[model samples]
Target: MTPHNELRLLPWSGPDGKPCFLSTDDTGGPLSRLADTTETAQLNVGQEILGHAMDVLADEEVETEELRLLARDLATALRDTLRVAVSRGHRLPALDPSTPIEANEGLRLSAAAFG
Candidate 1:
């Protein structure tokens, strides 16, 4: 079985001394077997949301509070999208209803904010 909690967070300094958060995980099976699958797609979507948040932060004119709140909102959106996708996928008996389909760390990070 593949390892869990493979989520890797990468923070970089953005404009105006703001920190940008990014993460990538491949817990959804191997790429040789089509990493573009739905689970993987969901992960990619989450990354996209993060990237967009970074772009929003690059504007440099927005308030820090607003940026933090936007980052949190994006994180939640990513989590919700991933959760719904996973819930709709195959229902394994051995797997717990709460067992996250992607990396466990990714699940935890689903609520991460820029602050």
Candidate 2:
């Protein structure tokens, strides 16, 4: 079995909405491929959510119930986007304050805003 530290933690949730970790050393392995596929699907869904939100905002006759439903959907999409970002960010090694900003830019940006 691969050591816990060596396994890759996937960015998306499982069927039960729980985090999933993979033990494969090969990036092209089945689990890794599945993760890649799932991540793509998530991003696509997030984009679709944004488009739907735009439609809601553009509608002049949108009802209060429709607005509430749109807000809930946006919240869910935001949560999923944050989860994926954190998952991908966790894969990076810890960075020191002295490290160049360009190196590990995602971690630096997110840590500053979200930490």
Give the winner by lDDT: 2
Encode model 1's per-residue lDDT on 24-115: one tens digit a residue: 33434453124235345556667787787888878989888888888787877666465544433322223455767763434332221211
Q: Find the candidate with the highest TM-score and give its number.
A: 2
Q: Estimate each model's TM-score.
A: 0.31, 0.67
Clashes of each: 0, 0
Give the alpha carbon lDDT tens digit for every residue of 8-97 in model 2. 668666899887787755767887778767666777888998999998899999999999988998887788777767766665556888
lDDT of candidates 1 onward, in order: 0.49, 0.73
Give stretches of model 1 more than 4 Å off. 1-55, 91-115
lDDT of 2: 0.73
Name the lDDT value of residue 2 in candidate 2.
38
